[model samples]
Target chain A: MSHAEKKARTTTDEYELIYWPRLPGRGEPIRLLLEEAGASYTDTAHEKDGIQKVVGALKPDFDPGKDNLPGLAPPMLRCGDLFISQSPNIMLFLGERLKLIPGDVEINKYRVNQLVLTMLDLQNEVHDSHHPIAVSLYYDDQKAEAKRKAEDVRNARIPKFFNYFELVIGKSEGPYLLSEFSYADLVLWHLVDGCLYAFPKAMNRQFEKSPKVKELYDTVAKRARIAAYLSSERRQKYDNGIYRYYEELDE
Target chain B: MSHAEKKARTTTDEYELIYWPRLPGRGEPIRLLLEEAGASYTDTAHEKDGIQKVVGALKPDFDPGKDNLPGLAPPMLRCGDLFISQSPNIMLFLGERLKLIPGDVEINKYRVNQLVLTMLDLQNEVHDSHHPIAVSLYYDDQKAEAKRKAEDVRNARIPKFFNYFELVIGKSEGPYLLSEFSYADLVLWHLVDGCLYAFPKAMNRQFEKSPKVKELYDTVAKRARIAAYLSSERRQKYDNGIYRYYEELDE
Candidate 1:
């Protein structure tokens, strides 16, 4: 097949995603993309003994046969004979396959990846607000440090990231990051939603100064598929995940 | 040109890298790739008034004519008309263009990127050990928190990342991550070098248990191009950079 023909083809391959049973966390973005594309996929996290499947896949001795690759952690995507890990990498693969990416232009795709990576950087900072010291430790163990870290994330880091996105939105001709709805917009939407859940007061304050980003978030949330998915049972709630709302962490 | 012929064509295009004047930080990987490829490129960070050039490019008001796109931050790559940012994203582009990535197989490229992203995650965590509270704040301002965070990184996070890489190395048939010496090896080399410099006591302890990773680091360091780069004045020292070593934070 020609390269163009391959790009035009729709994938019939089955996709199985493995992540934590509860808490949207990093897996939510992947779910959003799948939902937005109206693709057929299953989340092992939602299945019976799903969490076990996720845990087993991460084990040192867990084998997915000689053909399949092992994943480093949860939020793994299994498609056909491939077992791919890393949320951004999985998203890139799916985005191209689902034709959810904006254009065939090479530079445009690079721009999309750049935006997704920046969003991931912001998400990690938000996560560190509640667990500034270590991910393995409980929130109570790092409460004091979390308080200090949260303040910086709220007052400085959030604004820095928000302003960068706002500038990006300003550069665009439409409400989305690229002036046309792409996976980048979905990634940003989930991040903003997670921030709102984790630090309501702080995110509200930050949003007030970032009208463009807030507008983008609102625009993405209103998409028919996204709106339906947000209200569906598949949309996991925010809890002790990457974005957690600890009252003490929010000033 | 045919696809194979295009791949064989040498790129004569001029490349300019704009990054911080001092410190390797995230730009080291890009430098290593270019050096290994023997690609002709100029570093704006190394030129006269280079820091000013970097700062000006990042300014909201800076103009790059009608064709060039504005970048969010430094370590931006300007290849002819296209401008790209984000270290890992830039490295991905270079890896493909320079043919430094392993295997023409599509999945292998994904594997290379996944490893690079994982390394970036570890680098970010190592950075957080010193600036746990905020990037804008100095180490002295967050000394107590840094001390606590550094301990966790040394005892817990360092081992976790090193173990993962060691497992990866063990799986490979050669000294490199893929067993054939890809850009992934160069990136890991820089990360390990940074860690040893920033957390001497901690990395020393961690390396004791991760001989494979240490061996990989040693193998990468002995490469002729890397050795020349390391000894050249072009290589920046680690100071007030991402991997800063504060004696008080180390055990």
Candidate 2:
């Protein structure tokens, strides 16, 4: 077979996402993308102790000697023979594949990649809010330290991240960072919403300095697809993961 | 001018980098890429506090608002009129540009992006070890919490992460992943090395079950360019930042 023919034969699944079913968590952005692009996908969430079963199936399949798919973590995506893990990686792969990003190499790559990193920063902040001292410790065990950390995050880091995004939105001079609604804009909106839900007092306090960010969040929140997704059975709240409700950690 | 003609006529710098010079932090990957690719261009590290004058004179013409460059953070890059930021973004961008990644669409994009995400995860773990309680809090202030968090990271998270990477590498069956050296392998090696340096007992205990990971780190350590870079003044050590050295933290 010709090389071109071989290349032509390689096709990928529209999307297959495996994540914790309970909360929006890190899987939320990918969910938003799939919804916005009207892409078809299978969203599977595991039951309690089902994590072991999921890992077991994945473990044997990814064995280099057997499966030929090399990967590090989940949420994993199996596109044709291409097996991929890592949430942001899944987002980028999907974004590029769906043409949800811009055509221009420079601005498009920059904006998409930057937004992915921003999401990483946001994830770190969100996770730390609960597991401030250690992930192994229960929230109740770490509540005191979490409270202290939350106070600092509310006053300082939250505003810093918000201001950064607002600066980007202002620079673009529109609802989107790249002058059009791409997957990133949707993801950022989801992140803002999650943060707000998790830290209402902090969100209100920090977002005051950046009205554009608030405006963008509001606009994206009301998008037909996002609104629909939020109201659908697919959407779950912060109680499961990502952002959890903790009173002392808030105001 | 024709698009090709315009491209030929425009002699923009091949690559441009924006980063904080005082610390290596996240920009090391980009620096390594440039050194590996033998690419040349500008390295902009905005002056912090007292260092403004030194940096200002270095790029007297750079105006963030008006210039062709628009960067919200340091460790950004510019090629022609295009700008890119975020450490992993820069790594993936350089990976494609330098042909450090495979040509196969899925393999190239998925692997490199996954590798970047893994690096980000490692970075988060490192950072949390220090500022586990509060990002805004100084290392000195969070010393107690830092010690506790570091123990959790060393005892639990580090091993899990190491084991995952070992599994991936084992599947690769390689001196390098994907049967070739890619940016991901290089960054992964760096993460392992940094963790070991920061938490010797933890890494030693964790890495015992993962010979492939240890082998990969040793191989990357021998790379002449990286060795030279490490020996040079450019290689910065972890202190108060991510992957900090806290004696009490280590077992």
Candidate 3:
């Protein structure tokens, strides 16, 4: 089916997700949750030059005093009259809609929120590995800085973060956090998958020490739908976005 | 109350927060949530000096083959046998406990998550302003790189994020994101408070356009409990952890 037809076949929530047409990056988690929940929504990817049009389409009526116009950045979700940006926020909205969150309202909120933060931290680390010196400078320019940042991330941050999650999983009694599959689980899986792909050598070293985290990665991967999704072409590999495969970033 | 006596009064199940004590960076949100909720929780700050002792107290023994751990990081929550970490995760967990989240599950999750991502983005900008060159170096060392980075943040990121949130508040029908007070709102208030304090000149210049965001800030400030908390010893000033005062960072 054509892309337009596929989107038409997708559910009719007033939710319009505008993101980069290429790499999954941060948008993958939200897309996966929508898929798992079988929620109908529009996933629009802007072409390299399509950002301006996308921004115009997404921004509300320009009112300097009343309306906060120009909701900057992609990976924004426009549901009905509301426009929300940021990946974790989109995931939280979709998680609740999909029942991917736990029943215990308080703890579940904590679980999802905490998981999101962990993911963001991971993203920052990944970003730093590529552009350690400055965001404006290209990877070629920041090669030396990237090498140093990569070492620090691989040595200090990765093991520490992985061990931390390993502890959290141990506290729980079941297959999922709060004893059920949560978007948080999916989010954690995505981070692991991305990190492994991006830093294979470094991850391999840490994986041996973080057996529990590796196990969590395996278990989340084994989910029937998730397994299918990974096998599908829909799941893109990292190339230019946040987590990229740079030999320098690995051990 | 003596520190130990106050610590002793905190029930094992009621309050046990595990996070690095030296930096009030990530843990601030959880602290705010607890203060607003009026819930009792221990402030188990891991000290860097007595590293071994902190590690021993913080680590959880969990089997890797059979189960998974959910988190790693300070700002972890330990209520009874359950241990949870990740700052946003802890706050969400507490959001529910404190009844700060709205009742409608979807809206509640969405709003909370949205606010949390905003917090993360704000954090990224803050970190960039400080460590524009490399995370390995201190702000004093990276001051030159930081200056360039701060220019980008002030010119692009800060306004982009603030304006987006301002729009969110504008779209909301009432005072809060979902017409009711939530943990995300508390976080937003804190972000604004911190950014304003950290970047007074930048905020005065850029924030003039985003009245909705300013209005939201004012409303959150007027909250009686929050106001009291701000006046009390619990509210501390920025210390160059996440949001720091850098004169050159402002345009």
* Residue A173 error, candidate 2, Å: 1.6
Worst 10 residues of 2 chain A by lDDT: A1-10
After superposition, the stretches of candidate 2 with alpha carbons farther than 4 Å from their true spots are A1-13, A46-53, A57-71, A103-107, B1-13, B41-72, B103-106, B237-239
lDDT (Cα atoms) of all candidates against the true structure: 0.82, 0.69, 0.67
Per-prediction RMSD in angstroms? 3.9, 6.9, 7.1
Fnat score for model 3: 0.56
What TM-score does model 3 achieve against the real structure?
A: 0.76
- Give the lDDT of residue A222 in candidate 1: 82
DockQ of 1: 0.59
- Among residues 3 or more apart in sequence or in different chains, the pairs in candidate 2 whose N, CA or C atoms overlap within 3 Å are B18-B75, B18-B76, B19-B75
Predicted model with the maximum TM-score: 1
Rank order (by lDDT, best first): 1, 2, 3
Best by lDDT: 1
Clashing pairs in 1: none
lDDT per residue (tens digit) for residues A1-251 in model 2: 24553244233445667666667777778888777666677766634554663475466453433334445555666655666677777788777776677656445755686776776686677778777877677999888778877877777777777777777777678677767677778878877887888888878877778888888888887777678888887787677476887877787
TM-scores for every predicted model: 0.93, 0.86, 0.76
